[model samples]
Target: MRIAILDVDYRSNVARAACVTAPSWATELPLATHVSDIESVQEYEPGAFYKRELPCLLRVLEQLAAKPDVIVIDGYVWLDGACRPGLGAHLYQALGNATPVVGVAKTAFHGAETCPAVVQVRRGTSARPLFVTAVGVDLAEAAGWVRGMAGLHRIPSLLAAVDQLSRSTFETPPGASAANAVAG
Candidate 1:
């Protein structure tokens, strides 16, 4: 299955969102990548976390050459046992529930530990776990896919690559000043 991993990063007033697409079996590298930027993003709201990130994410998704079988977001699918919508859930809904979404969170959510849809995944002997949640797919199966992602660290290789790609857009190349650098 083709899985697209999504992540967003912000630098000043600019928000950069990136998607890395790869087949589930080939986790070593991304088959394709898309990036989108939004200027003057809405100020961060305390509770509504997806508000600022969603627009840019949607833009990146729109730029993809083809739709992915599933999307893996860098956060929770559900906030609590009540199945409160998180970023991944919102993305799933935005797509009209056409595609499955799996959330891979680096930190634990307060009540997620007990949620049947949430699984704690530990990679490469690390004691810390990445909380995995899913919509439209079995949580255990999602966790298995996450566990199989190529990596020796807490974050999967492709996910890490996506994060790096998002942040790199904001980075200034050596000898170039930030003022002259244009972020895409």
Candidate 2:
């Protein structure tokens, strides 16, 4: 199966989205990478974080050469048991609910323990656990996959790569940074 991991970073008025894809069997390195920059991005708003991120993510996904079976985001799918939607959830719906989404968050969300679709995962011997949530996949199964991702630290290797790729936009010519780059 092909899986894609996505992350976004904002600097000044630009928002950059980075996506890295690899076969599930080959987790050590990404098979392909894509990044897009959205200029004049909306300013951050208190309770509406998804508003800015969702569009940026969609723009990045639109530039993908192929669609992945599952897309992973750097946040929670649901904030509470009541199913409050986060960026991942909105992305899942915006994609017409065809592709499954998994969210991996570095920090715990308040009241997240009450959510049946949320799971806490610990990698290595670190006391801190990652908060994982999913849409269109079982929570335990998603967590298990995360546990298998390449990494010796708390964050998986590919995820960290994507994060770096997103932030590296600042070093590249306005929109030409990741267009010719492939991780594998």
Candidate 3:
């Protein structure tokens, strides 16, 4: 199975989106990595974080040659017990809800602990557990996938690589395409 893990980082006028593709849940390395730079990104809103992030993620996904079977994001699919849509939820909608999205958040969102669909996964001797939420997949199955991911730390290796990719700097030439592809 192909899994695409996504993340985004921002500057004053730019948003850098990174996609790390792994062959399976337990894969330690990515099969390919892609980055896209979206220009003139919206300023972050206090309670509407998805407003700034969703577009950047969508733009980067366009760089992929084919749609991934599943997508793992660095945030929540559902925000709270009330089921407010988060970034992954919005992305799921954008993709017509065909692909399952698993969200692995580094920290717990307030009130998420009360959500039955939200599961906490602890990995590798870490005291702090990762908060997991999902859409289009079973909550337990999603949590199990996360727990099985290859990593010796709290964060899975591919997740950490995507995080680092987002923060890494790169130059885009004038009038180039939004995406920059680098296969691994």
Candidate 4:
């Protein structure tokens, strides 16, 4: 199976999205996985997951019950106005090709020119850029897959749902405790 997984922080809840694909079938997500990076909200502050991403990602990777052929991660956060993390380079460094991984974002990052081809999506009549990377799957192949499935929208179906879900997850309070990130 050609599987792709998406991991992102939502209200400090680490939301995961998975899609399994084959020659004839494609399966996407069992809803989402919500994870918290800190052991307690009293110890860490809200939005800590997005701020301290390495710890957050460690928790997220642990929460993944099933492995995917490729994992796509969100890649942007700032320590200061001028010091933002490189989502693509960081994810690549973290994974080290041990497993295929890619970073996704709406905005462009510095050094993005070195990455794979970026998707120029124009669903029907609108023209806009979409995603970038050639981490696990080929860029053209991945783009074709999204173009076939993204429907009449600027964003792909899976990513659009994730974006909305992440925004909505923040509406609810993340509560009092953190997740035990140790692998089971």
- Flag regions of model 2 displaced more than 4 Å: 171-183
TM-score of each: 0.89, 0.91, 0.95, 0.57
Q: How many residue pairs in model 4 have overlapping backbones?
A: 1
Judging by TM-score, tell me the better candidate of 1 and 2.
2
Error of 1 at 16 (Å): 0.6
lDDT of 1 at 151: 83
Off by more than 4 A, model 4: 2-4, 7-34, 37-51, 75-85, 109-117, 170-175, 178-184
Order the candidate numbers by TM-score, best to worst.
3, 2, 1, 4
lDDT-wise, the better of 1 and 2 is 2
lDDT of 3 at 153: 95
lDDT of 4 by residue, 11-66 (tens): 33333222222221133333344444333322235444443455445454555556
Which RMSD does model 4 reach against the true structure? 7.0
What lDDT tens digits, residue by residue, belong to model 1 across residues 5-88? 989888776777888888773478888877766665778897788888877788788877688899999998888888888888
What CA RMSD would you report for each candidate? 4.4, 2.2, 1.6, 7.0
Compose the digit string of candidate 2's lDDT tens values, residues 9-77. 988777788898989823877888888877667889976789989988888888777788999999988
lDDT of 4 at 58: 48
The candidate with the higher TM-score, 2 or 4, is 2
Q: How many backbone clashes does candidate 2 have?
A: 0
Question: Can you rank all candidates by lDDT, best first?
Answer: 3, 2, 1, 4
Pairs of residues clashing in candidate 4: 14-35
